[model samples]
Target: MTKFRPCIDLHAGQVKQIVGGTLDSSTDALKTNHVSLEPAGHFARLYRDHDLRAGTLSCWGPRTTRPPLRRWPPGQGACRSGAGSTTGTPGFTSYLFPEGKFSQERLDAVLHSLDGDKQKLVIDLSCRRRGEDRWFVAMNKWQTITDMEVNQETIKQLEPYCSEFLIHAADNEGLQKGIDETLVQRLAEWCSIPVTYAGGGRHLEDLDLVAKLSGGKVDLTIGSALDCFGGSGVKFDDCVAWNNKS
Candidate 1:
């Protein structure tokens, strides 16, 4: 059964939902859909109360807003924090780094930082379809198209250094169009470790679809489409219920 995972995407230290592709180095290029006045801890507590674990807390841009959002809240359900390549804040069980430039130095730095503790690490991978309908990893907050293709070879290579994988379909993220079906199936077939797939989830139905497509191997996260995020496509309560039932 595919479980419904929740998320808190923090940009500039505030809780907000933005188009994944719009995240870039420049501020003006950003396209935001919802900005929550409540701090990131509020959502963290919500997830905790709902027992929504294995969710993602992603930092969108520069660390202008300071700590606490990307810094996972203590005592909350198990959540992964992805803020910087080398920094793992308090309460985060793992460091979910963005491999933006595909540099050996960057990979080595993360590996060295782990110091033989690969279980406390994760790689946040977002990919877009390009030539011949293949998924190639996008880096730099899903703005840069890297040469890294997310295939068995890549998964095999990264598996030695991380406990699991978190993938976002950058092209459909926050659009609420639909979950990336191909990516879900591919991830289910390829990943040996527990992998979570997020993007284009418009309703509770996508959860069932993901379950069927991935053979219940992939977990999901909804953002802009959720009722809590100023969208009416999916109800947060319904997702909670779905998780409980499944």
Candidate 2:
């Protein structure tokens, strides 16, 4: 069935849950749902102790501050997060994989980072609707328009690089309305690797619906609605119970 994966969204070195679409240049417009007083490493250790795999580490920082991530210990953490800048971070370059070629040195660093066993890599296909039921992956903090479409072909091309796919329906993300059911269904049919869906999950039942719709091939992440974050629609303990049962 659909398991509840964990997530730690970092903004300015703090764990935060903000409206997905509002993440643009202006920090003043952010609709923050919750900002944890706990440090990012705390959540990392918590998830590690719980054996929560497929947890995401989305770094919304302007610069790559990896000391906190290192404190989490990559050995003990089950996270697939990215740190990027519009221009690019120095050591951990923000540019896309081989596609967004900077220098050979930078490209090598990016590729080498994803090295190891197949399960080490997970590609994030954060996207928005293009037109007429069509969707395209968004880049550069979901601001730049990309021609890359979220079709079987796109997944197939990315399959060689990663063990799983993490997709956020950027439009519906953090809205707590409902999931893009069509997108979940489509991803289940398209992806060969494990996939996780995040965005617009307001209630606990949405997890069941996603499990049913994707035939248990997809997992869910609830942010604004979870009690741990701030809102109170879905209790964090219940999500743990659901995963345990599954």
Candidate 3:
């Protein structure tokens, strides 16, 4: 079954709804929709109403800011939801660490916001080197401070508390070019828990490719080519239909 999983990617401390392909080395080039002037949980609550479990909270680097303090001390007061309609959509939160910028304190803060519920969490092992914005380097090739490999180790440390993994072949991300078969197979063999592979999806058939390569275990995140992401080939509605049938 092809399920529709939406995302809210946070970059440079902002809640941006972006078109995947537009992201590049320069922030100025990225096309993003700013949702709030506050913390990320607000968005998470919105997804919850839609039954969107596992919405990702992605961070680009150490520059990522902490959510508002007032919202902390979870369960203290009623969770005030924003004015909107949920309409039952599925989503997930991921924290994409830029190369050499992984921080235990920052990760701890994100985990604390979840209030000890591992099932609702998904961490993105995404990283790029300094001054490089083309694509995220693979875990093995990374050598800098913000490497995804380091971030993966961090997630392993937090494994007892986390639920799923969201790893992207930054080298292939947003390209809609092709899949990195090696990475897909490796993640399926290495990770015990469920993981979503994002990057280099050019068509619907690519999903089938992933299913075969990962033994129908690993899922995928499609951007760039999706109709919503400024592309005309892939239809978001078709994905929903496929998920319904599955």
Best by lDDT: 1
Write out the backbone clash pairs for model 1. Answer: none
| Model 3 / residue 26 / CA error / Å | 4.0
- Backbone Cα, N, C clashes tallied per candidate: 0, 0, 18
**lDDT score, candidate 3:** 0.51
Q: Give lDDT: candidate 2, residue 180.
A: 94
Q: Give, for candidate 3, the lowest lDDT window spanning 10 residues.
A: 81-90
User: lDDT per residue, candidate 3, 1-246, as tens digits?
Assistant: 324354445556665544344554566766553334645666555444444333344444235543442433454321221101111111122222333444556556556666756655555554332342223433322222243342345445756655666766655655567877767776666677777777677787777788888887777766556664455557766655555565
lDDT of 2 by residue, 83-178 (tens): 343222211212553343224354344456655344555567777888777888776657665667888987887676567778888898788889
Question: Is 1 or 3 the stronger prediction by TM-score?
Answer: 1
lDDT of 2 at 195: 86
Per-residue error at 117 for model 2, in Å? 4.2
How well does each candidate superpose onto the true structure, as a TM-score? Answer: 0.87, 0.85, 0.58
The C-alpha stretches of model 2 lying farther than 4 A from their native spots are: 67-77, 83-94, 97-109
Off by over 4 Å in 1: 63-66, 69-77, 83-101
lDDT of 1 by residue, 1-246 (tens): 678988878888777888878888889988888888888777877887787887777766676343454333564436776533344331121123334346655565666766757777777777888866588877666766776788878888777777778888888988888988988998998888888888899988999999999999999989998878888898999999999999
Name the lDDT value of residue 224 in candidate 1. Answer: 93
Ranked by TM-score, top first: 1, 2, 3
